[model samples]
Target: MAQTGSTYTKCRQVGTTSYNKHMFLNSECMSAIDCAIMCKEVATCTAFTYDDLTKTCRLYQKIETINCELNKENGGITFTKETECHVNWETCGNSCYFYEGTTRRTLDEAIEYCISQGGYLAEVTDEEELDLVNSMIKGSVLLGCTLYDGYWQGRTSGQKLVFNDTMWAPNEPRGQGHKCIQIWKDHGKFDDISCLGIGDIICEKVSILRFHFIVTKASDL
Candidate 1:
């Protein structure tokens, strides 16, 4: 059965194309196996989802988008652009990370970009997504967000923010837009904020199935 939780962004096909049987991907994050393994271990991982927003993997579940870049030369982990990645909760720490930028954006716009990159807004639900979000929470970085529309509060219309587990401060959202969440320098820790706010975002890799083994198994079957 297909899981139901979040709604990721998808293109509307402005024009016609030769074929509709194509998948686009980018060179980012750790291997897809790593992401899958992590998601499998993370109980909150409802969908090992990938947002075509920016052609990147949104490991966590949030209502906003992230623009991340790999550490040109992280300590010694020389992960290449072509490396596959998985979003399973257990592998959050092991998977590669992109430098989620510190730019303010609207919630709708943010999510749109994330979809273009092949991932979706963060989806924090249980301890798994919680720990994952906090791990990436850093200076000038916004964790899970709740824009003016209040989407990340775990409840929009009737949908609940299933796996989210973070604390929030009262009377935040100082932005004129007062939409995007932000972590002020004076703020205490990870909590709900606005989307127009600026902060570092986290992303992962989308796994690609190794069809060779599947093909072999099918033949044997």
Candidate 2:
């Protein structure tokens, strides 16, 4: 209901529901956005209800079929966690990634393309992320890593490139004048290549949906 920062996605409203017995946590919040934040902080919180009039937020640990029922009153709005991400995005670990296979672009063009899709070039900070990204690529895929003035840096966040010894394949980065890095789908290793080389693009961003509830007349309920 409330839009805040752009890093994380918002929560969606599920209309007024009767779930008095399903409540597990109760706290005071200034608005539905505050309540949603509180719910996200708790790993067990699956759903929540915020009372606009009383400024109270109720969280549910688990949602069951019996816990939901249509209500005519406009006292509160229910927010539920969306299980599925948006179309064309794949859920991997805690983040969502979209791979563009239709078009190939240079390193600079790929970075711009990812930004235009509400995301940045995918950043691999750890082995798990690296493995996940490698699994998604069919062949060679462009990464966020770039060589700037002889120093490797992540183009997405400008972070220094740090990798384990095993991350780079033996005798890799063999090409001269290669400034951009790409991951091999066969071995999940990094290889420095020319920035002019066109490859598939991968975009990473938060995936969430926010929906607001609408209260109708008592007769309509």
Candidate 3:
């Protein structure tokens, strides 16, 4: 599986000499992978140093220089960010999303587009996720819900709609013939819209974390 978020390159026996002032977020992590995940969670963290002896991860908000000195006395692993974004997707909670802004597509076309990306139309399960999706979309966008036999169901596995009553706009669904659902970007509210309508699409898939190993000698640092 592919990893999500920042890329980390590990360097051993090397520690920053004068950039300690740039340290920002710090927490205890089980492994280097956990440290990388924590660094990715912090928007400003660009690099991190993990102390194997202390089991602590130190994140840096900025790296003004790459200078490093041999510190064999201290057991520390430094990871620098090579890139951001997990593959071609963005991380949100436990899922990865791909925002389509090229052109508006009908509901059917949107579904196909998401499938092409190895995902499906975004399925929102809670208010938090709904807000996350809303933040990514500027305008109305197609969701996974579709009308079936007078009831709304998700396009995948025919899962019935069980959203909270508050999720719907006041007097929404309106018993209209509209068979598809679109989420309003402003408030994360649901509204039934015509299936033929064209709108932006959000694709969702399971998130994976990728890790790459780079062994650097003391002289290479």
What's the best-to-worst order under lDDT? 3, 2, 1
Which segments of candidate 3 are over 4 A away from where they belong? 1-85, 209-221
Tens digit per residue, CA lDDT, model 1, 1-221: 01244332221212222212422222232444444443433333322323333333323222121111112212111112222354432233223323256664555654555556565445433444444555555544443345426444421223434322233334543335443343333443344444444455443333332211111122232
If ranked by TM-score, best first, what sequence of candidates would result?
2, 3, 1
lDDT score, residue 138, model 1? 57
Candidate 1's C-alpha runs over 4 A off are 1-99, 102-109, 140-158, 162-166, 169-189, 204-221
User: C-alpha displacement of 149 in model 1, angstroms?
Assistant: 8.7
Residue pairs that clash (backbone atoms under 3 angstroms), model 3: 3-209, 3-210
Tens digits of per-residue lDDT, candidate 2, 82-196, equal: 4345787876544578888778788889889988998888866567777777777777788887778767787756667666767776787675888888877667788878888
The C-alpha RMSD in Å for every predicted model, in order, reads: 16.7, 8.3, 9.0
Candidate 3 accuracy as TM-score: 0.54
Q: Which stretches of candidate 2 lie over 4 Å from their true place?
A: 1-84, 209-221
Clashes of each: 56, 2, 2
lDDT of 3 at 13: 26
Give the Cα lDDT of each candidate.
Answer: 0.36, 0.67, 0.67
Locate the minimum summed-lDDT window of 10 residues in model 3: 65-74
The alpha-carbon deviation from the true structure for residue 26 of candidate 3, after best TM-score superposition, in angstroms, is 30
- Tens digits of per-residue lDDT for model 3 on 1-221? 11234444331223423443544555666777778866665445667766667776666766543223224423345576644345767766546888887798988899899899888888775677677777778788888887888677777746666778877877887766888878876667888788888888988876653434344455653
